[model samples]
Target: MDKIKIDIMYLFGASGHGKVIAEIAETCGIVIDGFIDCDDNKKSVLGYPVFKELPSTTESLVVAIGDNGIRKKIVDNNIDAKYPIIIHKMSTVSKRTLLGAGTVIMAGATINVDVNIGQQCIINTNASVDHDCLIEDYVHLSPNVALAGNVTIGEGTHVGIGVCIIQGIRIGKWCTIGAGAVIIRDIPDGCTVVGNPGKIIRKMND
Candidate 1:
């Protein structure tokens, strides 16, 4: 969807993450119609009404949940909803970068030239994605995470807060890089990595 055409939008998931997205939307001067959540007990969020079901409207919708798996599930189920790329006003995204639908770039994030971020991905606050980075669908780069040039993060992978990845590293799908990890080597799929050199402690399904 065209970002410029977004006048009013709705956010799915009425939680803390949703609140952050609301602030980003507001900062971008986009009017939020309301929030949609599965929780019946949630009546409102950030002064906006919350509905149990998505409203039938032409406005765009943003999946505001922070969990990669849950966000992917919601996007898959809501195939008809228009998903737009939500970039915070304070983010520094190069015009040469390509951001996929349903992706959210938080404040203070820096995405450099030729970066391609996939659908439903989260480039969290203050995260720095250097040039030529490829971030696949449903991936989350937590706050203050730093990726050097030519890094590739696979689908559904989560890089924890303050993690630093060296240049030309390829991290595989569904892997978890723990907080403060310094990745100096390639990571295989489905692994849980931690420590300074990013050792794989265990497989995700272990």
Candidate 2:
């Protein structure tokens, strides 16, 4: 992706996930201007002022929300906003890896060679994405989740914390892989998977 020259950076969402994104920006030596939150009750985050609207000046923004659907919604609503790729200083990303705009790679995360991660996705703290993995838009690889080589995670899927997927497995769109589940085979779209060797427990409504 092309480099985004940000004069100032602001994070959208002022909660726990937003705090972590703020630290990632600070670790990267980027100063956060403030946080933009919809909640009027949130006066500030991490000592930075919280505003209800985006500043008029040219600035980059990162959607700091954790939910895949909501992140996608925010990105869609702000189509003209500049969304930069935010990678934590401690994360290891390959030179050949292709990360889309607004994707955040958190501290201790490792994205191996030939990985293609789409926009507004979150490779959360300590997540491991092995080589040749294709993670679609708005997906969330939660902390400590592991993916074997050649894994393809479809759009809007949330791979829960500590979940493990074997090589060459294709997880379908909008699926929810529950925490600590072990995926051994392909998962269908809109399914909610759980347990070891992950079994589809239910299908989510469209």
Against the true structure, candidate 2 reaches a TM-score of 0.94
TM-score of each: 0.94, 0.94
Ten residues in sequence with the least summed lDDT for candidate 2: 1-10
Model 2: residues with Cα > 4 Å off, grouped in runs: 1-5
Residue lDDT tens for model 1, 27-140: 887778999988988888889999888877746889999889989988898888789888998999999999999999999999999999999999999999999999999999
Model 1 stretches with alpha carbons more than 4 Å out: 1-8
For 107-152, candidate 2 gives per-residue lDDT tens digits of 9999999999998899999999999999999999999999999999
What is each predicted model's overall lDDT from 0 to 1?
Answer: 0.92, 0.92
Total colliding residue pairs, candidate 2? 0
